[model samples]
Target: MDRSSDAPPHPAQALPVPAWQGTWRFTLPPIDSSVPQARHAIRDLLRRRAAPLSAERTHGLMLILSELVTNAVRHAALLTPEIGVEVTVDPHWAWVRVEDGHPYRPHALAASPERQRTGGRGLLLVQATAQEAGGSCGVRATAGGGKVIWAVLPLDRPTGRPATSPPPRSAP
Candidate 1:
């Protein structure tokens, strides 16, 4: 592949005009402390919105963000000192993306069952969580030689079912 400009594999998302387009952007140093702060920022954003997420949904979203950001801080800090986080939402779903300026390369994070307990399965957990909620998660390289990890999750429970409580049992 003839590469010219060092940019992300995916083109940057165009910021919608007026800035009220349900998008949240965050810039934070890739530090351990930023993890919690990032989560809080996202939580506050969701809370301020008109829609309310079930506790399960909120927790799941936080987990996805935490792992993605944590990985950047722990693994990519050598190349990138700052992390960029973005959240875009619609009626049905919220898309979260974490971008860092680390050099772009395939990240080997899978571990064998025996090794899994020791660690290195953050992405696996992230994928599982997103899948459980009928969403998707993935990574992509940026033009700046960094990469972005993203997850798309529903803002509400699946149709005809509740996330937590089962439908009220009908009187027998």
Candidate 2:
């Protein structure tokens, strides 16, 4: 009948490594002008993780993040005061998610003349950029009553063998 005896045994502990490896999450207040800040944060996170990213890839990430955040801001404007954006970067990919109070799923903007007339192209940009980076993008409703528009970029370097020794130099 001893209470201490009824408790489960503690689990074994795992040693921590000196190297840094884990997901980094950031929550930003919904600001009217947060695109720039979002880009900066994503860049910093990627750099800190030592991601093998090039300048072009970095710019792509920034653009995608900006677009996603902007879409969330625009579509979920009414949910902003109580909502925020979350950006996460892991070893293999980076993600940006906007949390709102609404439960609507994000739909890609059509390219019809009427749909295009309104100038709503954020989702299109996200899909194209993600595809260009050898990645994929999509949206899903969260269990907590909101939706997340996310894009994943592969960390692997582009195809093509690394450069070997230069061709034999011509006689000087």
In model 2, the runs with Cα more than 4 Å from the true position are 1-21, 82-84, 87-91, 113-118, 158-172
Candidate 2: residue pairs that collide:
none
Encode model 1's per-residue lDDT on 83-123: one tens digit a residue: 99998865456778899987654344676665736667788
lDDT of 2 by residue, 50-160 (tens): 666788877887888888777666677676554455554444555555566567776667687555375676778887887787767777667777767667665555223
TM-scores for candidates 1 onward, in order: 0.74, 0.70
How does model 2 fare in lDDT?
Answer: 0.63
Clashing pairs in 1: 6-143, 7-142, 7-143, 8-142, 8-143, 9-141
| Model 1 ranges off by over 4 Å | 1-21, 104-111, 157-172
Q: Which prediction has the highest lDDT against the true structure?
A: 1
Residue 157 in model 1: lDDT:
34
- Each candidate: RMSD to true structure? 14.3, 13.4
